[model samples]
Target chain A: MPEFTLWDIVRNLLLAARWTVALSFIAFLGGTVFGLLLLLMRLSGRRVLERLVGIYVQLFQGTPLLMQLFLLYFGLAVMGVNTSAWLAACVALTLYASAYLTEIWRGAVAAIPRGQWEASASLALSFGQQFRHIILPQALRIAVAPTVGFLVQVVKGTALASVIGFVELTKAGGMIANVTYEPMLTYACVAAMYFVLCFPISLYARALERKLA
Target chain B: MPLQLDFMSILVQWPLLLRGAAWTIALTAIATLLGGMLGIVCAWARAGGPRALRWLVGGYVEIIRNTPFIVQLFFIFFGLPELGIRLSPMTASILAMTVNLGAYATEILRAGIEATPRGQIEAAESLALTKAQVFTRVVLPPALKKVWPALVSQIVIVMLGSAVCGQISTEELSYATNLIQSRNFRAFETYIVGTLSYLGLAILVRNLLYWAGPRFLFGR
Candidate 1:
């Protein structure tokens, strides 16, 4: 049996934590872009587009993310498209995050009084112009805190990627525990690392909410 | 070859799937009851207990909130044996879920509790109601009512999260799907069924909570 000092386990977990961070960043960024598009579609006043986006959001939000990852990982491969765990994890997390982000931003946009839309329209502003100049500016302010708060969820969600063989902090801890027979110490470190990464964001989100309120 | 999906290969194992779904519901039900109680206690601690107890509950909530549920499951299942507290997969899954849900519930309930009007508590006290009666009669019902929706959403979230317990070999819905897939090599199809089942369960649980909340918990 390989003897792993506490430092060894901590170091390896920290190294793997980088992937957790990276995956979270990718998922959050991609989710934001896709979520923005869906938000626009929902707000476009086309009933078809609105309903379509609504189903998309509901489908993603309604399911467990682990199943989504499995479907992507195995589903893609079975379809003859070679899919790495990395690709599957990224895509799944991106879609999952997108669903929640769209909902969050939509709520923020919905909070805008109807008069703002009417006022902008009476100014002869196009929908795009109205969204860009008047609606988005106000909505973005409301959306910021929640969006940041969702990043913590993204970080935690990355832990699920480990099941599909992506070696993030959680997976790394499992491997170390297997080899070093230190599940207790190893997983404690894993939990600590996640807490360290997520707690600050959670606290900051609350602070932002207070400040904004 | 063109894409092919034979969900029948998985559906033929309906008994396994049914059992898995039952386990998932049972685990969630037990955890919800236990965790909801834990949340109420912790919320009281945070809202009105001693300062030291408040700090302790605060720490518990923060630690549980920040970590992933999977890691928490792993820790409880694998780590606790070191402390001479060995738990079976089912037990550990329940414990982790209960702990996880309790933390979030505490926060949600505390919000409701804090929002209780000052005059209401004062009025209850002047009526000579004991502290316990005041809390149960004057504060809790309205607080639960105010936060019922949020609590329902959290319960749904926790139910969806129990999917991770399958990784620990808990024989939940996802575990059954994994077994079916491994048996027939119908991974994708099996997962689709499992995922849809989860979505169905989430919707079902949410509606159930919403119905039960007003009917049995806080009055409409």
Candidate 2:
């Protein structure tokens, strides 16, 4: 059994923390891009397109991320596709984040009010021009607090990637704990890192909520 | 090159898949009952507890909310035993889920509690209802009802989260998906099955809650 020092465990977890950050950024950024496009499609008046996006959101939102990851990772492997855990984790999270983001932004856009849309229409603003000029700016403001709040969720959700064998902070902590046979000390350090990463975002979310209010 | 995949083969593993689904449902049911009660208590304490108690509750919520559930599970599963308190993986996972969901439920229910009109509490007091009686009959019922929708949605969230317990080999749906995929080489189909089953579960849980709401709420 490997006896662990406080500094040793902390150091390993801190090193793993970088991957957590990297994964969060990748998932958030990628999810946001996909989410924004989905938001647009959802609002498009074409009933088929809107319904398609609606089902997309519901499907991703409705399922557990863990099962989705398994489906992507083990399921792909069974198909002889031979995907890496990294790719699978990223794709699963990106899709997961996008569903929530799409819903969040759609609400923000809808919050812009019918009057504003009518005003933009009267001004001869094309859909692109209206959205690019009038609606998106306002929607972005409304979207900020919620978007930041959802980032906290995306960060927490990334921990689930450990199931697919991606060695991020939580996964690394598990490995360290198994080797040392000390769960609390390793997990305390794990929780601490997550706190250090997440508390600022939580506080910032509150601050934004206050500022917006 | 053309590749033909046979998902039909994996269907032979029906008994195993059904067992996996059973465990998942059991896990969901246990966690929901325990977490619901635990959450209601947490919600009450956070809303009305003393200053120190409030700090404790708030801290618990913040720590659990910030950290990953997997870490929490690992901590309880392995760590508690060293302190002479042992738990099986399923027990530990359910405990973790309850505590985690309890925190969020407290937040949700606290919002509902705060939303109660001040006049209503004063009215209850004036009517000579004991404080405990008032909380049970008047305060908690309506407060929970007001936030019932959000609370149930959070429950679904936790139900979905239960799949992560597969890492510890809980033989839940995710665990079953891994089993079928490895055995049949029908990775995509296995996932598709898992996804569809999970989605169905989510819907079923939500519908069950809604259908049973009036019965539970009004005791009809």
Pick the TM-score winner: 1
DockQ of each: 0.90, 0.73
What range of 10 consecutive residues in model 2 chain B has the weakest lDDT sum?
A: B211-220
User: Which tens-of-lDDT digit does each residue in B135-164 have in candidate 1?
Assistant: 989999999999999999999899999999
> Per-residue lDDT for A57 in model 2?
89
Per-prediction count of colliding residue pairs? 0, 1
Best by DockQ: 1
Estimated TM-score per prediction? 0.99, 0.95
> Under CAPRI classification, how is model 1 graded?
high
Q: Model 1 reaches what TM-score against the true structure? A: 0.99
Clashing residue pairs for model 2? A75-B187
